[model samples]
Structure formats: C-alpha cells, structure tokens
Target: MGAHRRKGDGAGTVPVGGGRDRYFDALRALALVRVVTYHAFGWAWAGLVFPSMGIMFALAGTLMARSLERPAVTVLRDRIRRLLPPFWFWGAFVVLAMLVHGWMPGWQIVYWVVPLGDPPGNAWGEQAWEVLWYLRTYLWFVLLSPPLLWLFRRAPVAVLGLSLAPVLVLTFVWQPPDDRFGTGLWDLSTYLCCWLVGFAHREGVLRRLPPVAVALLSVAALGYGGWYALAHQAEYGGYDLDDDPLAQAFWSAGFVTPLMYAKARFGFDLAGLARFRRLDRLVTVFNARAVTVYLWHEIALVLAVPLIDRCWEVPAFEAHLPLESQWFMFGVAWVLIGAFVLLCGWVEDVAARKPPRLVPGARPATPAARMAP
Candidate 1:
C-alpha cells in the first residue's frame, strides 16, 4: 500500500505536475518494481537494499493522516471503497481456482468477502493469495487510525517509541501463536512503527527534529536490526526480512525514517520527472492502478513460466532467445502485467467512480474545433 492519489477534476487526462506530489507517486512506482523484481528472482539482499514494504506502509500512513483531516467515517468509507473492488474482482478468480482444486469449504469462507482474517485458500492458490497479509495488516491500520492519530497527538515521541514495544515483546517474551489471529497481530506489530513515522511526517515532527539526532537514531536502528538478522539467520534459515518479523520491524523502521525525514525537512521532490513526460506518465499510471498491479503481479509471474516454456517449442525462439533465463521470465511477467492492467485495471477507475478507462492517465485528446458552416 502507498499514498492514495485522489483523482483530479479531469476524467482521463494524464496526471501532470499540478495538485499532486509526484515524489510519493514515484516512490510507490519504484517500490512496486522492486517488489515484482524480488519475487521474480528471489534475491536475498533485496529487502536490505530497498525495504519496499516498510516504505510503502509509511507512505500509506502519511496519506492516511492527511485524509483523516475529514470526518473519520467518510474517510474510512472512501478508503475501503477504493481498496475492495479490485480485491473482490481479483479474489473471484483465486477462490474459484482453489475450489476447483478441491479445497473444502469451511465457515472461514466469509473471510474472503471482508478479509478480516487470512482468507482461506488451498495449496494451489497459495502463491497468489499469500500477498493478502499486507492487505489484512493495512485494513487493521485503517480501522485503528482514529485512536492512533489522537494518541500520537497527545505524546508524539513517547507513543512512537511505545509503538515498537509490541514487536520487542513478541520477539523476546512470547511468540505469536501459529494461528490466523496471531498472524494478523504479528504483521500489525512488525510495521506499526513505520506507520507512525508517517504520522510524524505529516505533522511536521520529523521536520522539526535535528538532522544529527535523526541520523544517529536511524543508524543505530539499522545497525541493530542488521546484526540481529545476521546473528539469528540460523534460527530463521535466512536473513530474509520476511522470515524474521522482529528484524523486519527494526530494519524497516530504520530504513524508512531517514527517507521520510529528508522529505519532510527538505523539499525533496521528484517533480523533475515532468521533463521526461513518458516516464512521468508511467509513474502516474502505476500509482493510479497500484492495487491492480500488486494484486495481479504474482499470477503474472506464475503465468510467465508456462509462456516461456511454450517459446522453447518454437525453433526460432529456442535458437535465438535466452529462453531459459530468469531475466527472460521477468520480461514475460511484465508483458502479462501490462495485459492485466488493460483488462482488470479499469475496475480501479470504476471503484474510484471515475470514467472507466483503458489507460488510467492517458492525456485526453484536444477537442476538434467546430468547422464553420
């Protein structure tokens, strides 16, 4: 999840420089690219390099804080409206596939509609729906934001430190039970600090902090998180942040703080992308249909394997193509991703109550001048 860009007045015009923060949009686009790439290749160091999930949650938290300026009920309604249509549309195919593969139905099927818990799925659909953990965690954050924001306003620094306590307790004292509810709590605790940092950014708390204090705090967090992951790699099987929630929480908190602080304190912006119109437009589209991209990317990668296998049957492709390469599969995945954007992405537009469009941010053509009779 990232900053939710509200639709401007124009129905189909490409998002330009005005009225939107291209910086956040660009961050989201890059984070998404990193997510897809990491999944495709399974690089161990990918999380350390970018910590995309932490960045995403922080961005979402910032946006949530901004939106909460309105009535809480209205904000919550609009947020859920924007999120669920794309999820429901995506879930229909996933759930159907699971049933066809003989997944027995339990009352837990209700979770699929609202996703309050882990939506039940069979082994076959595991790869596709595993990403739902983020949505579940995000939903929890959204539901809890009013109190969180109110609490933060009362004691900014203390609440921010206290937010990390759950993860520390989970790590040192008791582990979450191996159950759906426990899993949800673990996920929520892991990123809660990053989420609060977003609140700090929006409230100008980060901006007011001394740069040296920010740097020192960030470095210490990163150092401890990295050391913990490396030292405990044996227990978790690898230092992959996903495997170790404690490490992930600390690492992401460290990684995201400086970036958010910089942006909050300085006027760090990606407005320069306006000069490269095509690239800016691509970022705009990615941000516009971010949910669609995230929900469908796993399936796209899964399809890429079979599609590439078909290429091996063709003599010309077999001879000339690096068909066996993961890079090739990465290319195929994006091709499928682009196709999905065209096919299913329009649902996002409809969910936003905008005109359903083939391309979310394509520049509207100028109206032809009337010919004089």
Candidate 2:
C-alpha cells in the first residue's frame, strides 16, 4: 500500500500514478508502529488491541490477489524480487556481524540466503532474527497464492473453512506438533484464514455479506476466542497471546474480519485539515519504506537497550528514572528506528523499482487525471 489513492479504490489497478490506497497505507503504517512498540515494550494489550500481524497478512493477501491478474509466474517472480532484496541485505549484515563475533558459518547459514525455515541465530543476532518467521511464512504464502486464489475463487466458503479447520483441530482435537517445521506449519495454518479473508475482500465476496450477518459472525468468533483465551490463560502463564497459539489465531480472526468489514463499509479516513495532510505524508513515507522499517526496527530496539541501560546506570539518572518503563523505551526505539530507516530505506525504493527518496513525496493523481491518456 502507498498514499496514491482515495480510501475505497481497488488495490491492483494501474493508474497514471501509482494506485495505492491511503486507507491501507495508513493501516500498514499504524501496524508497523504498533509492532515496533509492542516488541520494544512487551505490551501484552498490543496484540489484543491491534492484531497487527493478521492485518498485515490480510493486506498482503489483497495485494497478492491483485498481482495475480498477471501471469502467475510473473507475479511470483515479482513477489520474490520485491521481498528478497531487503531480506538478503539484512541477512548479509546479520551474517557478517555473527562471523565477526566469532560464530562459525555452517550449512545452517544457507538458510539466510533462502530462509524457507528459521535460520540459526548467534547471541548477537537472536533478537533481530526472531522477526524472520514472518519472512518465511510470507514467502510460503506468496509461493502458494496462485493455487490458493484459484481454490478461493471456485469455492470461497469451503476454502475459507478449510483454511481454519487445521487451527481448530490443533487447538482442540489434536495436540499441535512440537518440531520446528510442525510449529511453523501450525502458524501458517492459523494466518492462512486471515489471508484468504483478504482474498474474499479483494474479490468483493466479503462486501456481499449483509451487515447483520457480518456482525453476527464476528460476535460468535470473538465469543469463542474469548472463552478459549480465558480457559487457557493458565496454560499460557498469563493473558499473553503469544504463549497461546490457538487463542492468538482465533482472536486475530475475530479482530481482523470485523475490521475488514468496517474498512469496506466505512473506510479509514484521516479527518480534518490539520491532521489529514500531515498524516497523508507520514503514511506515504511509512508505506514506501514499510519493509525496511519493519525489518530493522527490532535491531534498533535491541541496540537501544544498552544505551537505555547505560543511562540508568548513571548515578544522577538512576534514582529518578524508571528504567524499565515501556514509554521510555518506546521513545528510544523510535529514535533508533528513524536512524535505521535513513540508513537502509533506499533498498525498499530500489526493490519497488521506484526512484530512491529518503521519503516518498508523490501524491495520487486525481480521478480525472487518472482517466486521461
């Protein structure tokens, strides 16, 4: 998504200027901010409040559906091209840092080049590498999207239900497997529902549902998800969604489905003059550099931890400061994120085949202009 269209415009359309939607750009930007904040501060409520990962997958799914208008091979090639460059850049940096720190490079290191599975991480890069699961999962989704889309188009409800069945079984009937591939597959099963919901959205299937029907389904999903979360709270050690995969999956579906309905019914509009223009530009920049920001923000936060700790160690600062405060770390994380964005954001521009800019400044051409030759 980019700030190149009005809220209700279609995702895949090719207009005179880029045809990205401001609503999606803003949502994605907010997701990026929320994820970075949640990671830095350990905010338990963040998952419940936003379900950022689900939203992100849904957004990607919509874009993927749009991309499929072209040949599937072309779409796959483009997806890999756009996705892998930034990953390769970051992976190379991580590898270099690990090698310099005396970690031996081995066969597992090959995973960095093509991270179909989670790569082995050294002590220095473990925190940074935690985010790679998304990359691996996203890669799988992209590879599978053509067939998935075909299945979705043929039988939307059946495809959607089938996607969710694995999660339900693993959550209730069968124990989820403990191996890395098994867990990764389990996670994929969970998010696939959200992704297919996105496909429904792109194809106008979601919009066809009566508002009452949407609301009722949402309530049922939320109710079951809530019951599951409460029942399994002890199993998870707390209300932390990350610890309970089933709850996380159900709750995310509950949250994302209704939001998608709302987005269709009443788009996300930045109201008023003062806020709109400022937010427009900010969202533009964020969407343009989203991949870079997402990939590097954790590393920034990890790096900032020592600086914050050093600050706490200062005798003058120690007594008055709450070193572990989430707000405090959030501020520090943003600063570091800004720095990292400036350093590496050009890669996103290059990957997108757009001219490199520190920030995106182009605005969507008007509808009339878009209709012009």
- Each prediction's total of clashing residue pairs, residues at least 3 apart in sequence or on different chains, is 0, 0
Stretches of candidate 2 above 4 Å error?
Answer: 1-18, 174-177, 266-275, 309-325, 362-373
lDDT of each: 0.83, 0.74
TM-score of each: 0.94, 0.86
Error of 1 at 279 (Å): 0.8
Compute the lDDT of residue 12 as modeled in candidate 1.
Answer: 19
Off by over 4 Å in 1: 1-18, 369-373
The best candidate by lDDT is 1
Error of 2 at 290 (Å): 1.2
Per-residue CA lDDT of candidate 2, range 29-91, in tens? 778887887777676777777878888888888788877978999998887888888889888
What is the C-alpha local distance difference test score of candidate 1? 0.83
lDDT of 1 by residue, 225-315 (tens): 8998899989877888877788888888999999999888996787798999899889888888888888899999999998899998999
